[model samples]
Target: MSLGDERESSGGYGGTGQTRTRLPDTDPDSYGTQRRGPRSSSRGLVTVVGVVVLLIAAIAFANRGDGDPADDPTTNKPEAAATAPTGKQPVDAKAAGIPTGYAHDRQGAQSAATNYGIALGSADMYDLEKRHAIVNTVYAPDVATAQLPDFDQAYSGESFLEKLGLDKNGAAPSGQTFVSRVIPVGTKVTSYSDSDATVALWYTSLFGLSGESSRNPVTESWYTTTYRLKWVGGDWKVVDFTQKEGPVPVGRDQRASTAEDMTKAVEEYGGFTYAR
Candidate 1:
């Protein structure tokens, strides 16, 4: 059965109220020590060091009186807002080419959900081996094992592949590039614990084929996916998730990129390792 058929038959894992859509045809050096010199040279160096120290001390005192710019309401510096960077670093490891090794906190759960959502929506999901690897890496062990066969059946349908202008193997036709990308606009932690957390990722996705001969030109969709994550083996892994179509915004009046340009853009640009 195809993904749509599976969704219709059983609602699928984490299907919730999500509407299933048809597939479009589619990352610093040190210095060495020096030898001591003459007394005058040593004294000069000491004087210079002392002067520098004093200058630093003076600057510190001046800044101390002013307090932190962030703390000072009168300061012109922008306040830390919800949209501001959280200073949290992204995961530094990869499992089956998907980012892993997330921190063990709410932010980590959110990050894991966001990245996993991207992986789930990626073009790689269309390929059996790649999809399996992604599922094993992103989902909890039991979930991965249980869902593997379902995923394979859902994504491997010959009709589904053909609808997207792909072969049974999910490869695009020659000279055509399939596009499937999810860009997380934001994430929120709705629930949290040491062992479990629930995160919602709001995102926009581009999917379809970017080629001159394609009938389903690349198009964008907005979605929000809620992921229930578990801390497993020192990393956040998906336990369950649900997707819902947009909280979509009004479409903007802009010229769409040509197929060649879209293909080039997808090829030239790289996806991000998202963080909170």
Candidate 2:
């Protein structure tokens, strides 16, 4: 989400003036030197009164839902009706750095999808031990065991790391910054039930290397990753997930930062713990 990124003080106040003639305390048509007749003054007063009354009505209407959320739409709705979590709490516990033990509901399914997306696409995925931990913690137990061998080969194979400008050990070469990160834009619950739910997270992933000498430069790509969540052992776990290209928007013509700057930015920026 990082694209990569004053006050005026008044000198002096004018002194109060004392050169105007004071209007008479009582005069028939002398409210001011320009003079307004009583009838005109009354009309003016009525207009002012009307505006004040309207303002009061508007203020009251705006605050009508302030007292009780259950009694009003503006106070209770939007947040409740929206796809965002509906009063359900995100997991307070973590399993091997991944959030787990989600509530067995629609909100929990969406939350699990978001956190799983991050874990699956994180830079840590490049490391064997951490990657295995993530898959185990986020995936259904049986599936994690099954995917382990292939998962290791996919990330640890010589050609795989070489293609991404990384060593066989998954470390970037000297003077290069490795970037593998996914930023979840939002989540959508396409389907839900007591036992199962399907959620999709639309996200942008940054991958490749930040080195002028490297062939693969860090870049962003958009995809929607759908997760089929199962309510396993009182928590939502990913049974399977898939990614498809875009819902991509047209690229904005912005200045491209130098590789050095991009490296610095990625190094300094920390990833977010997202909840939907």
What C-alpha lDDT values do all the predictions have? Answer: 0.73, 0.67
* Tens-digit per-residue lDDT, 33-104, candidate 1: 111112343333222233444444332333345556667545664666686565569878998888999888
Best by lDDT: 1
Candidate 2 lDDT, tens digit per residue, 193-268?
Answer: 9988999899877766777775666666677877888888888887776556668764543446777888888989
Q: How many backbone clashes does candidate 2 have?
A: 0
Stretches of candidate 2 off by over 4 Å are: 1-89
Candidate 1's error at 112, in angstroms? 0.7
TM-score of 2: 0.67
Using all chains and alpha carbons, the TM-scores for the candidates as numbered come to 0.74, 0.67
Instruction: Output the lDDT of residue 213, model 1.
Output: 75
